[model samples]
Target: MKELFKQIPSVDQILSKKEIKDLIDKFGYPLVKDSVRKSIEKVRDEIKSGKLKEKIPEMVFELIPLKVEEVIKPSLKKVINGTGIIIHTNLGRAVLPESVADYIKSLSTCYSNLEYDIEKGKRGHRDSHAERLLSTFFNVEAATVVNNNAAAVMLIINTFAEGKEVVVSRGELIEIGGSFRIPEIMKKAGAKLVEVGTTNKTHLEDYANAINENTGLVLKVHPSNYRITGFTKSVPAKDIAKLCKQKGVVFAEDMGSGNIYDLSELGINDEPTVKESVNAGIDLISFSGDKLLGCVQAGIIIGKKEYIGRIRKNHLLRALRVDKITYAAIEKHMELLLREKYHEIPVYNMIFKQAEAIRKEIEEFISGFKLENSELEIVETSSKIGGGTTPEREIGSFALTFNLNKSPEEIEQYFRSREIPVIGRIKGERFLIDFRTILKKDIPILKNYVSQLLSH
Candidate 1:
């Protein structure tokens, strides 16, 4: 067999450069001459070794490279977020508003007053954009921002009590979204961790007993992810503030997943507002920008003027300061909030949307897909406030459910393989695309996907 295969002309010997170019021209740029040549060479090598018997009809397929421009594309492409998870942490939480995106695009294109005061024609601070607006909106004396909430907390702890003790409730010492624990962060800041109370219960006396000569700050951390249901007790910020003030200690709060607007009107759980925290006489307060605030990722610290000034002077401030683009976005977000334009915030809109309104949208979208006599259906569904905000809270929503010719797993795989990935939860052996987290604008995209499914 080997001798006979050798006698027959090898694929490399049979196919010439001109022949390959002819094939490429017929099949478009995908049939690149170089790739075709390599394929033929491999085929020739395999045939000469008498391995042809092991090959199948599928082995005839050839992968050719198109133009370099077509082959190489940008990694940061737009992806469809159909997972019904809002503020999806993995897919870059809290998309910037169109105006904010434009602002960043402008800065990226040319030079601006990022670190220079254009009016004064002199060097200036980059943190200037967000500082004033953040303070004004949150009702704080001053404010500063960092890369993230954890960075803000570390910078605060390192600044105020590097070598001293920071008293906190053991229950409040929580592990955030990532495995980043509070106690570990404090230790890294060179502050002694003085934990107070038990896992489910803590009292003002516990904090009082922990206080002593080494005590520099009384810290309160908000349990962002989980809430203790029954038989739970903890000291309020007002009481802790009074006790800390009497003992000459700075009372600081880490209000993780910070919120500014009232969610009660939207039928969401009423979380403590940032203004309330500041009003409780806490000296320093830090919270996140992206979570409930519906802004870009940043750690916002707002508190008394004197304490903010001290934090600004700390050596770590320079390292943790936010960029001009972040500052601009945060400033714009605050402006919208302060002006009572809640519709501008995407998160608030998604959470507050009524069931009737969402149902109407889904019904309109399904109408576009005639389904070629296929049985397409719209059913009532439930949506969640994802990103670890409310685990048990499910908002009323609507979804387009139907029976596909293929199996449930096949339908899911097909949707995912589209130009834009559509991720959703599966229930009762059916895949679902909940419209609760989906915006009205994304309906056209969903329609296109449904059209593709029907065609297939």
Candidate 2:
């Protein structure tokens, strides 16, 4: 054991090797040193456990470069979404348009009027960039934005209902990603959550009965990720707004995935639009920019100027505020919406793409591949609008099912090991690639990837 341990090269001796010197030239010395340290630690542990028994120098030299490569690899690389779930949260929801990306790049590299008003030549509000567009698009008096929808909800509660009672239905208290619950957020905001009615049914009278002098607001949360049926009845936004108006209290709603256009025309009826909520006379409403809106991640709040002004003044607003890059991206996204260019956005393009078009693309993709050991076939599959929106509805889509040489898990791991990882779904012992979420430009990359894999 002592002889084996003595063979292990010291850090200075290892750094003197040709391969280690080459690695130092490629990646800086610090990274190479860290990799060498890690490799040495791993070898020591293995030797102590009696697992390492051969030539030690050869093993250590061979392991150092691999460890260096692994250590230097980036964690946030882009991956192809072969999975049929659009706006998949795990895959980074809502791919932004090219224009938005270009704008973000430009804004990130250089300074802009983030807080300066060019026309006024003085200090201005950062929210002013998207406020006019949001006000015009949603037909609201004023608007503001935060980092995310959860922040928007928290800010609203802390701003208006802090140290006061905010009535909400037991059924509408939803838990979103990361185990973030509504009541917990309300408590964090220093607001008293007053639960009204039962989980299955909540009447307008229940809200009216809950209102009192200490009641600050009546909140109606949209159940974005789940649905209740068969015996569930909840108060409509109009009725809730009317009750709040009559009771002289604020009425607000947290629309998790805010839609701008009516999706019913595209056969999706359950997802309500922000336009409808604004028309219902609600005092304030909030929704997400990254989900159904197909933009960067933001929490957009739109409502009467009175309530929005108060929300802007809240101390938490500074902590939850978005940066200039977000403002630039959102402004460009809103410009597309204003121009009535729904198909230009990635999420809408995926949702509204015809099944026939997707089938054609898949056929073209398959025509280029000459498989030796794998069988590929096109099959009809259902694609979902993920990101906690429209849980029960699935859009009609087409997928390519690959009967490969390896097991489903092995093939999936092989694809994931590629430079730009290809994420797919496994069904009935086969790997599936749903073309609905894939962009047209990604076809060439996918083709090259498949060709390389087949050659191997």
lDDT of each: 0.77, 0.89
Q: Relative to the unseen true structure, what is the C-alpha lDDT of residue 286 in candidate 1, on a scale of 0 to 100?
A: 93
- For residue 367, model 1's alpha carbon misses the true position, in angstroms, by 1.2
- Cα TM-score per model: 0.84, 0.95
lDDT measured at residue 398 in model 2 versus the true structure, 0 to 100: 95
Per-residue lDDT tens digits for candidate 1, residues 224-292, read: 777777898988899999999999989999988786656676567646788888888899999888887
User: Best by lDDT, which number?
Assistant: 2
Please, what are the lDDT tens digits per residue for candidate 2 over residues 1-456?
777788889999999988899999999999999989888888888788999987888888888998988977888898999999988999989999998899899889888999999999999999999998888888889999999999999999999899999999999888878998999999999999999999999998899889999998888899978898889898889999988988899999999989765667557888888889998999999998999899989999999999999998998999999999899999988988988888789998888888999999998889887766547789998899898888998888899876657788887888888888999999888888899988888888888887776666
Residue 70 CA displacement from its true place in model 1, Å: 10
